[model samples]
Target: MIYAGLDVGSRTIKLVIFDTVVKESLITETGANPLRRCREILAGRKLRRLVVTGYGRHLVASTQGGKVVSEIRAFAVGARYLLPDCQGVIDIGGQDCKVVRLSMEGDVLKFEMNDRCAAGTGKFLEVMAHTLEADIGAIGDLALTASRKITINSLCTVFAESEVVSLIGRGEETAAIALALHEAIATRVATMARRVGIKGKAVFAGGASLNRCLVRLLGEKLGIELTVPDSPQLVGALGAALLAKHEDGQ
Candidate 1:
């Protein structure tokens, strides 16, 4: 029997299927109708149990039957499963950022979240990448090659976008500007993590965690050796899947 977990995130719809014989996950754009996209993804799947989590958890739960878990709890469970010694989780999603402190048993002890603005989330990077006329996937690698570290003073997405554009017009290197954006986000997220008192063995999970430059900068700013799951973006879904299995007594 397969246990499925659906994570309806702001920018992506992630699905994970777990069972005694196999473990798999899939990612798709959330698009205009997330519930419809999710239905299409699970069209023919046979699930013994289902669990939903993330920003759109309630929406998915209302249209589908599943246990609901907070993103904080889901990340903690997913972190522990991937990094057995994990004590903290930093998840930077499309529109929000979360710093979760976890217990040895995978319970969420404490967490700090930034949901009011897009300054330190994936959307921030997306906008920066667009301003620089660069691909989001390549921005991280490009940032790593910067010879000088530039500072992005603005904390607002709109101002930051304008700043990036101005810098480009002033002949600033794209690489340096990209790194600055990552650094800015890392600093903001690190501050939030410190508020919860970061512990040892921290993990970075979420779509933004896929940015190598951001992950490195975040580790440096937090002064912690951060680890990323093979599929960081799927961590929440994986956690939900694990929850479904337990809920089903499978």
Candidate 2:
């Protein structure tokens, strides 16, 4: 029987099905009607066990029926499974960022999360890309071409946008501005990782993990190698699926 895990997040929904190995996995934008998106994804599938996680986990659990797991637990478990020797996990999602420190046994030791604002998150990157009038999907790659980027001090979304505009008016290179924005995020995330006392290699998960610029900058700033799964956004869902399989087996 296939066990399923669903991570219904603010910006995207991830689904994972496991039968000895991961047999099915998908990631889609949450869109305006996230519940509908979730329902559509789960349709016509027979799942023996289901576990829900992410920002909208409870919403999915109450309406769709599944075991609920916290984002912290899901990331820890998922990172541990993907990188068995991993000591921590960092997830930079659409609206928030999470840092998890793990024990050798894959238990959560300490974790930090920034969900109070859009600053230093995927939302920030999206907005910055829009402000630069650059393709959101290509912004990361474009940033990689820049020789250097200017300093951005504000973490607030509105303030940062204003800063970008001022930089543009001053004839700052578009690529440089984009690179600076990603640098800001890297600085913030690296600071969080250090504050959490993370050691050894860590798994980088969530949609933002797709941004190569952010990944490289973060890894450099932290002075540690970051391991990314083939499908980083599905890590939470994979964790939930593993949990579902464990529960069903029991």
Off by over 4 Å in 1: none
lDDT of each: 0.89, 0.91
lDDT for 75 in candidate 2 is: 83
The ten-residue window of minimal lDDT in model 2 covers 147-156
Among the numbered candidates, top lDDT falls to 2
Choose the strongest candidate by TM-score. 2
Predicted candidate 1 versus true structure: per-residue lDDT over 1-250, tens digit per residue: 8999888998999999999633778999999999899889888888889999988899888878887999888888878888998889999999999999887776788899999999889989998898888999899999999999889999899999889889999999999999999989998999999999887889899988889999889888888889988889998998899889988776
Off by over 4 Å in 2: none
- Colliding pairs, model 1: none
Candidate 2 — what's its lDDT? 0.91
Q: Give one digit per residue, the lDDT tens place, for model 2 in 1-250.
A: 8999999999889999998999989989899988889999999999898999999998889888899999999888888889999999999999999999999889899999999989879999999999999988899999999987578889789999999999999999999999889899998999999999898989999888888999899989998889989999999999999999988874
Model 1's alpha-carbon lDDT is 0.89
